[model samples]
Target: MMQLQAEDFGSWDNPALDRATWMDIGDNCGELDVAIHRAAARGDVAELSRLLDTPHDINARCSSENSALHWAIVADKTEAVRFLLSRGADPSLRGRGGSDGREGDDAALCAARFERVSVMEVLIASGVGIYSETLGFAVISKNMDMIRLLVGTMRYDFTDMPRLQALEGILPAAVRTWSLESVQYLMEELKYDASTISTNNQGVLNLALLAIFNQEDVHDQLVETESDKDWGVAIQIIQLLVAAGASVNAVDDWVARTPLHFALQLQYPPSELIDYLLVHNADVNVPNHMGRTPFFQLLTRSDATEEMVRRFQRLGGSLDVMDDEKNTPLHLVKRPEIASLLLVSGADPASKNKYGQTPLHQASCVGDIGVIAQLLDYGADIEAKDSSGQTPLLAAMSYARCSGFWEKDTRTINFLLERGANVAAFNRDGQSATQLIDLKGYHINNLGKLALKVGHHVRQTQDNREEENVVDLW
Candidate 1:
């Protein structure tokens, strides 16, 4: 074996050697140095072995402070990694010499980054210290086995705040990936408390529910079998967490929303999970930060189902409960089924929100004839005025121009007219329904024209009745 001079190894300041680094290296290195870097990176065991025996510096630092072992591990070259470890390579060496003074990649960290469990084992066996960030990397890769090896077998301190933070950070990803086994290992075997681990200040249940909700949105559009698999995993994880004693009513600190609230807000809400949580004694009427209960949240979704409303009612959820805005569940009703369910459950249709708007007022705004009719059937005040002094008739006309559904809006206006909605009523702005229509420049179609004519006739008939009463009294 021929021994090379120190000068032949090249100075660290030499741009050729400096530019041939791994991640931090620029593409300005000489071809020879680049070839050497490539050989180590690609894990060409024979070539690396031949080069190593030539008195070349095995621990030569690249521009980014990465050594041959770091490159080998990053490339996932298990054989080259083993060979280098056996050849007295320092597994603990970190990359250095960057402008920002940032530490370079170590062998263990590199192995964890690429999720090479075998290489990680070899590095750990070589007495390399595992950083908290290494565990986070494994979690990021969703490698349950790697996580077990690091925390369970390697005995990395799980009590450390960084490790705990890493665990918390990965909970959402675990839920998103539907990694029930990994979640179970973290919660059960590792004793990670699901209640304590939150993503964005939301507990594990909240995170799981949000994940399910998002997956449901995608599941609705997908026609394949795999679409349901993710949702199924989410459901299982929710069940697993509950069975493991996770708090079903754990409220998100930011929104004060429980898992049930999230479940209700989904486009295709999961009834099974809702029922499961309720069975576990999750509060059916727990008020969120805005004072809205799960029932209130349910009414906000356009696809609120009759079965969901019935489930809540069966669970003893109160329909008349009001939020901070004083809006009852009935005030937010967008679907006829929801309205009907509330009515059957003894909800007050005439209930006024903080805005003094009744359920009928809200129904009129949306031009939902079914909900409007149901509210009326339940004795909702069609002429009821809100705090703004706007009646349901005026409310319907005011909102009609902005609703974009001209036909639906016209039908709602005409329905209110035929049902004796007082179109002559004025709001607090001193604006009557007809005045508002003209002020807003609403283009009323033929149906709106008929409604106006019928409204005028009704008002005239009322005036005539008053005159007749006065003559009789005289």
Candidate 2:
């Protein structure tokens, strides 16, 4: 072994770095380390030979605890990884020393994941089983060159690997940067589970939802490939997972919402997907972690279509279903059209939420005089108060955040005042509607309060049979 200093080889430059006469057999391990380094830098295969012949340990662990082969493979130096592999540098050696429980920790998979296509090809041709965790990184990165080299050229089984599970939820996140065609390329070409039939990870669902939200071309693909599809393609994805032994009721961890419930809660229309879930027997009443039922989720809609409303009705949904706060679907009706639907569906206009405030109180807050009149015609209480004893008119005024956005119905306010909705009626805070407005004084006049009381009685009498329809709201 040569005891030469680093300066001896300081100016040493290789021309072919081959099986020539310049075999430096100094410190065997030291020379081997330097040989691997030079081989990596110049892609010289013969320099590696001279070092192997010079008596260095091919499997020597470097200072980082990785063997020479580990660093070489990780750097994706094909000649070095191959040379070490050929020289009995164990391919199963952990790049970082293996933990007591872990099995088969190789650096070739890491190289493949990072887009070292050549190195992956070399390792695969040498008979390394593709590691799924490393393969997940490759799939998520969408390194098609590396993916093809691993699967197509090497004949690696995509479904056989357990690490592919990690990629299930990651592919969707790539859409923020990659094209829809890229996502489709993975889905259609690589079979990366566009339907995600195997994993419970929400990454696939999130990507699908986002694709729809962004109106990506994958949405068109989902629609285009709908023939012979179950639960629509969207719902069928879940259904297929279920049929393939995936959980049908798998609630997502982030929102704690099942796929069916999420379909109802989304702002954009779900179209056939919603129908597919219902037809496939998805639990319509499944509540989210927040205790909000799918019915309440649907009720949160502002611009909900008539079709959505009718579908909820047809799905055996009860109008009386309450949210955590005890607010029924009727309490959330913002438009007169929805109010009419709720009323005709037998929603009690006078029913209170958990707050003991009726749908009338919420309608008042909306300040839609038309909806207020419709509620009144449907027998809403004129003098109903919440747990705080505040009247509907006062409830409406409390939520007026902007200067003019609320613009309360003066006609309805006056009508309620006339019907004996006491102008002096104070809530638990002892604030009256007139005082909430910082008025000059108690403007509680008698004439307005009288008209409100008369209209209330007349409307109540007209809807005497509302009790009859309540049982049929389901």
Candidate 3:
């Protein structure tokens, strides 16, 4: 649920809307340089010449401390920019940065943002300095002409202090555009390494692979009926990055999750994305920091495929890999098909998690009767005990008290009774299934009836066994 704004960089049509929403007429503009600023905005060089008597008037600050030069650059008035620069207008003044930005951008950065190549040329001629951040603005905005002016204007020793840092940093921002041109420009033209990481320790390849998810905090984009994400350009973007030397197994610093993990954890995982990563020799069962493998995440989804399980297994996916909680992938099985798949793939049905809960215990809590049947078929002990000494049947009964229709299924008790779950079983808490149901007014008539039926069945089976062992005089 980490809120991500990865698409905020490239979803803009107007340059002004993208960067200068802060210049929306703040307090105190009475002594405004209205005439000069208007002339610059109109690209009126003659009017600019007529109004300017000295440097004070020519470089006067307007809304947000933006000068006539900044206004002219934003308006794409190249000739007016030249006229102002001739009158000694300083191009280094920075306006007050809007929200979501730092202390504002310089005239050089502003021009780069609007893609004013000629105006930037004029600024360069007037001794205005370019920066690594300026190149960032050009790359993120997808302005090729501005990119050319900056890169071509100065043989910017791309290896220098800030330029190298800037180029490396732009890799993630380029990925944010979800556009090939943006990312390709950096990797191919600017020579930014495909392996570069953002400041948050996310590798470029990891960011690219995760672009299919467009959520902030809510995963509304992932609430799919049957995997609706197009991923046409998105997958290709990831492919391009991988081809450019991005590592397929790039792991994050936070959770140690590789791209394969992302593909598996989120819903509607693109088959192409999974196959592409596998083809690149991504570690098949690379566990996250908590020991949850991509395979573990895969089975959590209801849509897990047989081929997907086999593909991961063929690549060395471990079926019984235990997480930090000591729960194996099979221990969290939610579907009968998946349970059968994991069991056939060599999962340990009797394996215990940290709480001593087996797969049967987990199935009992969720009340998935199908999964219970599958686990029992695969040799899950019906009488298995957890740390509480609770049998699977007891675990199921206790879980019904788990508040409001969750963590226990009402249907499971019936199935377990049919499977002959022992009613004589008692947990370490000294509570049998019937005692548990009556503990806190949680007992319902249906469960009480089922409990009585199980007790009668147990006694009936005991009497049958006693009769078989008796001397048959007849």
Candidate 4:
């Protein structure tokens, strides 16, 4: 005899049959009833019929508290399900020990989960309560038929705030599953407010942005490929929501990021989509919770394009907008091309961030020699001191020393020196650039040697100038 075990459940939360229930049932149940449970799970109509001929507990729950009807529905045993229902099996009885546990799911939920529409009809006709959680499961499953059955037949109040909240909980899942039809039904038929913000303060627009962001992250992990079907669905959903009056300016309550902020951060943001939002009057300069404008966010992305940057500019994005750190678009420049574009667009090269660090100071920290050169060409202060009193040259040397990328560091250091960085200047800690390098145990590199010689000459010149001033004073 092949005895069934929990592993036979296959992907079900509770794999093993409940031993205690089995033991109790085995002591009382006849061999025929046991065979009936097995027959129901396997969808053996003939075996079920043979067992049904004799007296049996039609709604007999097994060790897991799952009646034979639950088993039939879970296994998509349509015929067996009909027979069990005809025999007065209780469809409303909840399954006890599955993944969701005793209070989690009923036969209706199992039918919906497995997409057993016929079985679902039987359960619904038998008067099962469609709870909000059940609706959530259906929404997340993206089974339009099940969702329709629950909403249309069961008369679930889609206008109820609790139900709308439930729908919100599954928005991400719906997007992932490409449940466009289900979303349309909710928005069009139920008149669910597409712009209504959820308890988390995210509206449909914000959710769509989050979906695109997640898709981009997934794209990063996978090899480049063709446009995903889900991407198409996402674009369509955004279009549908926008046409239905979803706000393009909807900001998340927590991060306060408008949809525009997310659109610009996409790895390969669709130009048309961006333009659509802009045409709809999406604010390009609205700051988020971090006080970062969409333009500021764009600078943080290495993939930002000249055309994208230009579009924001033409739409009145301020080049000098500062983030919470007071870093302007120029201060956050990661690419030389972006730096050039910003400078041409009137970004002040000498503008300092909250930390008093100039664009040149930022370029040094990232070892972008090209951006450093570009800023200097535009007359950025080479010897500007940040709040810590570390000049651009000192910033470059400190970053290089800590980063362990000696070659790039050496190139950046040598570049700064040739561009008139003051090597003898001391930071707030009273440590000159050479002294800082010595503290890092790397006082003998090419840049270090140059700094020492330059420091001696600059210090001597400073002394001479001071003496000249003293004689004048006397």
Candidate 5:
């Protein structure tokens, strides 16, 4: 073998960065760190290694204050995360990386929220902080396997009383997620306090009830079938909380309304849960801080069916009940089905709110032709006026602008006109029905500037290519 001179080996043999190159990287490290972020985000571990192997700190953050480890976590690049961790990326250092509409700031916590199990496993193994908040985020994800990984891991033991105590705050999240598995794990297995009030001073059980509306609002997730929905998940969640000492009759600090109040008031409230709450002594008539009872609050819901109204009345939820504004259930009802139920069940259609707005006026203002017809049939004065001196016809025109500007609003106006509703009537605002309608048309026209907000766009002609003339919605 030939003996190699140190001079020959100086720049080419060892193959590490020279002193000046190291200094140069340190000087322009911010720009290079973005390259590292881009590489990690793309999961190009080969490029990641090449960047980190440069003469600089492995934990160097990019321009956005996120480290390469954060970009890897953001992109769900599990292998890249592992490679970064192995290459000395600080797992303990919180990465301020977050995606659009993603909830948390900590990358590991966001991982738990999104149920990125493999990514979370790599993070946990690399000694990421077992934040108690992260535990709640894990529960919110409703992923049993992810929950198992966190609590079952050696470093993050639920059996550790301190950790268990720290996790007590996770009950609200468990309730909100409606995850029966999480409920059982936290309440049954770990004994997290189900009776614990939330930060808003609301009962944990009430949050479980309110989350029914919340879960329905998540449009991205595919709707699960009833059988596949973990067998009446809402009712089961309520049952678990109640069984764990949560009070079905408990009142919130803000509303002073019990869990029964939520079950009755919200749209599409679980019927089985309502039955469960009532059977367990949930008082539907208990007054909230707003001076409204559960029955009164129930009236405001647009989804209450005719059968539900009759059933509620039979179970002591009286249609005779009135809100703080003195509006009877008949006045508050928006659906024709519920209005007919109340009218037939002896609710006076002539009832008025504190503002002297009669039920006919209420129906007209909401542009509900069915409700207006129901009220008229039930002896409601067709020409009734509110305190504002607006007749039913005038009321329809004044509020028709808020009718979501749909064709049904004009149909309601025509319906009233056909039923002897005077178009000559004027309000205290000195605006006649025709004048108000003209103003509404002008408003709709100006909505062109806010087309996105109004959700209005001219449809195409029959050919479906070129833009057609704007249809006069008014």
Candidate 6:
């Protein structure tokens, strides 16, 4: 029965106004305030009754565009909201606050965000049901307590929402606000079961990756916690996951990569962690989603020296293995020192990736004349054609515009041409090298022909984009 004060009446846009004036007087008949007159915000009954007695509408909207009923419902003022409803206020009316008009959904979300359990209860009793937005609000609130209540007590389905399902690897934005007590409550007291983690769904590893990148301290803490377990806890977790019948060789279904692929890509993993996985017989040769084998990845680094190379070799890693593209380790080596070790260790220069292009094709494309010479010395094939029927020299020409090659590249070009690379060889399009160069507006030369090929690929990509013009910015 609180009285609406004089200050409550003012402009609807203003948050503070005289509540009594807004309730008792119509704006056209007399000056009426809106902001303070909101039933939920004012919580004043005498002013509300006075306004009801006047020609002024009981459900008049405030500056925020919310009717008095909308305000009371959102604020969880049940009695005030009920009184307004009994006087013919619409309980289902939407407000300017949230886009959704179902006052129940928006208010429940706000309540979850504020951690107002009582408010949430009152809203539920008033007929609000769980929805995607509310579930998301709970996660974004980082109120694990609220999530537990919603899931356990309210029987909300945790896996039903697509947004929640897509949140793999990314920590809830609100995780930063979680207290240590909250963390303990989730991991220990509630005994929340993390799914049997595989690389597919955002599993424990995905969480670990985000933690490592976003909040290093949390990552360090998790690492420390695992260190105390038998089997080097994390390693054991992975092992147990595999042993409990998770796929040890589960190549990433999307990229066909294995978990080992990600571990190696991290650039700085715990040495002990790496050693632990290796000791447990993790496949060092497993390829990832991109079809890149572990051995191929190791050879990609300029920093990998004799010792690292030797360790991998000693570990029985294959050097000639190719990814889905058939790219051999020997094909990508730029360091002469590493190349020497590779040959001495029996690396195959004639090996090809799925594309059927050999190490010589790769070396020439990079304009690495030194590597080219070394491969030739070891009897590498220069006339190899990929599935596209393009030769080493043709492939090299396609990339000539990317980097400046030494004038001596003519000798390599002439060598391949003379060795049957087909100076006039047409690609899959049946266009001769000369014709391709002419069509692309470049002079008829090896490099010029390569430019034409690049232009062709660009045009193809552009066409694809134009066909799918409705791009999602999000």
Q: Against the true structure, what is each candidate's TM-score? A: 0.73, 0.61, 0.77, 0.75, 0.58, 0.52
lDDT of 6 at 85: 49
Off by over 4 Å in 4: 1-36, 44-60, 86-88, 96-103, 152-172, 191-230, 427-430, 436-474
For all candidates in order, the CA lDDT equals: 0.66, 0.55, 0.68, 0.67, 0.63, 0.52
lDDT of 2 by residue, 1-474 (tens): 122333432232223222112222243433434445545334466876787788877666543344666555534567777877887777666543234654434665546433567778788888776555565555556676765565456555443454344345444443432334344443443354435543544445444444322232221112223223233344434443333333445565544565566555544545776666667666667666666766666665677666777887787766767776777877877667877888898888877888888988887776766677788888788778898787887776565533255324444555556545555567677776656544421122245535534543311123233342211000
Candidate 3 local Cα displacement, residue 328, angstroms: 0.8
Cα lDDT tens digits, model 5, 258-366, are: 6676556544556776778778877667776666777776666777666665666667876667777787877777788777777777889777889989988888877
lDDT by residue (326-352, candidate 1, tens digit) is 888788777888778788878898888
Better of 1 and 5 by lDDT: 1
Provide the lDDT at 368 for model 2.
64
Of 4 and 6, the candidate ahead on lDDT is 4
TM-score, prediction 4: 0.75
lDDT of 4 by residue, 1-474 (tens): 224433343343322224224323233331224556789878888888888888877777665566788777766688898888777777667765434444635676667655667777766676655556566667766667887777677644332345555555656556545568877776654364545634343355456444544444321132323365445666777777666556788776656677777667655667676777898899998998778888787776788778888878888888767878788888878888999988987889988888889989999988888889899988898888898889998888767766988778766766777666766788777878656544543323344345546554432122233222121000
Flag the better candidate by TM-score, 1 or 2.
1
- Cα displacement (Å) at residue 245, model 4: 1.5
The order by descending TM-score is: 3, 4, 1, 2, 5, 6
Point out the higher-scoring one by TM-score: 2 or 5. 2
In model 4, how large is the Cα lDDT of residue 142? 68
The residue pairs found clashing in candidate 4 are 6-15, 6-16
lDDT of model 6 at residue 282?
58
CA lDDT for candidate 2: 0.55
| lDDT winner, 2 or 4 | 4
Off by over 4 Å in 2: 1-35, 52-76, 88-106, 127-131, 143-256, 365-371, 401-421, 439-474
Report how far off residue 250 is in candidate 1 (Å).
1.7
Off by over 4 Å in 6: 1-37, 42-105, 113-128, 141-252, 266-282, 302-316, 334-338, 354-356, 369-377, 381-395, 402-474
